[model samples]
Target: MLFNSSGFLFLYLPFVLAGYALLARVRPRWATGWLALVSLFFYGYWNVRYLPLLMASILFNYWVAGRMLAAVAARRRRWLVFALAANLALLGYYKYANFFIGSVNALTGAHLQAWEVLLPIGISFFTFTQIAFLVDCYRGLAGEYRLVHYTLFVSYFPHLIAGPVLHHKEMMPQFERPPGLNAADMAVGLSIFVVGLAKKVLLADPLSTLAGPVFAVDAHPQLVEAWIGALAYAFQLYFDFSGYSDMAIGLSRLFGVKLPLNFNSPYQAANIAEFWRRWHMTLSRFLRDYLYVPLGGNRHGRYRNLMLTMLLGGLWHGAGWSFVVWGGLHGVYLVMHHGWGALAGQGPPRCWGRMLTFFAVLAAWVVFRAPDLSTAGDILHAMVGGNGVALPHGLEAYASYFPVGCSFEGIRWIDFSGVAMPALLLAMVLAFAAPNTQQIFRHYAPCIEQLLGTPSCLLWSWCPHSYWGLAFSMLFLACVFSMNRVSEFLYFQF
Candidate 1:
């Protein structure tokens, strides 16, 4: 279920939270079972029939890995490989089969028709998590497995949908015990969730409104329009994906589990390497440890390893050539950044490097966002100085980016005279410059404590501002919750 949806906010989350907290006090083990069952219901909320498939996957891997860990025979290692391959085989059949079949059909001019296949929800996430579990089992690192803990690890609803990709080691301990809810953690979690909700509902959705029309139009416009469209999309995508990550982190915290932070203001990076370090950090780390290292990483000649790692990393996103191109572009950026740094014996000027890298990354995002390679090429062709059409008449015709009839101003009678331009300008500035709500509030704690003249002992020992912040945070969250049609988290597809 979508975190932004009213059904999820009003119905599912409330019901689950109430049940969980109630059960936690009386029966902790039962609480975990309730969670696992509820999590299944949550996944089935999208498609009830798929619940069996997901459950079977969890059961299969759980049994196989348990056996692998318990077995001592030499052939047990080979059986573990078979089990891992079978799990991957299921994933490939569902996710990549059509992508491969279509490519093959086009290449050979054969009469092959693509099969209709529905990708299971959370398959990409759960599959990877289990694969890690299996590998840990093979290495004899996985401990005694409990069915409840395994189920919770695989199906915890917070990161289940789109993940920070939790490792088996990271989540098992939390499942093994329940901690009393800390008021301070709840306050911080609620605050983060509300801020993320605002980012998705208010900022990302409105930016998408600005982006959609320009991107949808087939014929190119002036260079100015092209740049505007691409820039709007870049901003929309970042806020949307990162906004979801924030909500996920917050929700995980509600259960007394700390999820790894996924983003760190990636736009502030001075180079492509720095950008990767900040953006989608968990995924980047996964690629570095699992795929890159397996392919020799930097231990082999630098350029070759970089290219191979990136190409595989690109393919890991999806079974598409465009994804490959996107990864390859970043690989090229990394290689260039490293070589330049080595030759100069120092990093480039921070500001200039950041600007250049930001634009280059932005340009690559066009390829990543496009529906297909041809569409990507069309957008890029327009972007790099394609002056395709002349405006119809006077400057008034194309004065606004929106079409004549469906413009936001045309549809709504909201006063444009007072706060519209100022709000837009403020939002744009805040998007680029202002510290995130998390950072700002962290700094505000000290000032708030001092302003209240609270005892130094009490103030330092506990979060003095939590109660006040919690109330305001809940109100803001309610506001976001009320806006039900906000778009799904952007990373859900990946």
Candidate 2:
């Protein structure tokens, strides 16, 4: 069930929260068990067929981790390798088998029929979380394991769908703590969730109206249209993914658990490295710890390891060459940033760096968002004015604003509705100027990073006051009103 759906918002969450609250007072273990069952039900609500697959995965990993913890040093290393390989093998078969088959078929002229495999929801996330646990067990970093706690760690609904991927050391202890409802946490979480709901319903969904048609065009879009579409998508994806992350964190907070921050105003990042540091941060951490460090990281050399890490990281997003190219572009951007820093002894000026980084990220997003390589190339070509530029029909009165001798003929603006352009601009302004959800809720320590820093005066802040409560209530009601056409979160596909 989608987090945005009424069934989830009204029925599922309320029932689970009520039950857990009641159980927490009498039996905390039963409360934890109740949460685990509820989480499993949540996952199964997406597809009953995959429920067994998820259960098997959890059981397998738990057993493997137990073995890894008890083994001798050399045996532990072997067990860790075995467990990692088993997880990767499952992920690979479900996520990559068809892509690999298609590639081989194209190259070798073999008619290898790809198997019809259904990827279980959140396979990548749960698999990686388990892998991290096994590695930690091998290294003696993880504490004692309990089947119930481990299951809860893997199946917790908030981070289960799309994650700020949990680490065992960070999450398991929370499951062991006494569970109870906190009015303060509930208020703050609801406020943060309302903010996220507004982002998705009011901002991200509307922006898709501007982006969808442009990207869907069979022919190349006009220069202005291409840019509008590209920028619209850039903002659409930003708010969509960031909005989901906010909701996830907020939901976890309602359970009195703190999830790591996944997004941090990445559009404002001054460099590609900084962008990576902010965007999908847990994924970056996973790549750095599990993949890059194991592959020798920067210790051996910066360039090769960085490129390989990003290349695999890109493929991890989806089974598409476009994603590979997107990852490669970011990899190139990072390498160039490193080279420039080495020669100049410092990075570019903040303003210049921010602009450059945003543009580079925007360009890579074209590939990421496109259906295929050809469409990406066409959009990129149009973005460079390969197709002529023109103002829309209503803007003809501004012809005098153009350079002398310049003709407006043949250049055409996209025939957007009255609200599209304004909405797009508004979304952009908010993206660049507004404080993120974490920033607004900084006082509550809604995310891990907030634990160390003082709250800043910015666009807005959540406070335990009547005005803030009324504002959030209005936002939540607005989101509820817009829920007629329920849409899945964009990250759900990944």
Best by lDDT: 2
Off by over 4 Å in 2: 396-415, 443-464
Query: Which ten residues in a row are the worst by lDDT in model 1?
Result: 406-415
**What TM-score should be assigned to candidate 1?**
0.86
lDDT of 2 at 331: 85
Give candidate 1 misplaced runs (Cα > 4 Å).
Answer: 73-76, 388-428, 437-478, 481-484
Instruction: For each of the candidates, give the backbone clash count.
Output: 0, 0
Query: lDDT of each structure?
Result: 0.73, 0.83
The clash tally of candidate 2 reads 0
Pairs that clash in candidate 2: none
Pairs of colliding residues, candidate 1 = none
List model 1 lDDT by residue over 1-494, tens digit each.
78888778789888987888888888776888888888888899888988999899999998888778778868568867898788889989988899899889879987688889987778888888888788778777788778988998899888888887878788888877774455455555665776677777766766665456555646443444556567777877777877888888887777778787787878778888999998878778777766677677878877777888788777767778888999899899989989988899877799988888889988888777776777677777867655443332335555677344322223121223543334344555765677865565556433334424544322222244545544654557566654756577767777
> How many backbone overlaps does candidate 1 show?
0
> What does the lDDT come to for candidate 2?
0.83
| RMSD per model, one decimal | 5.6, 4.6
Error of 1 at 377 (Å): 1.8
Number of the predicted model whose TM-score against the real structure is largest: 2
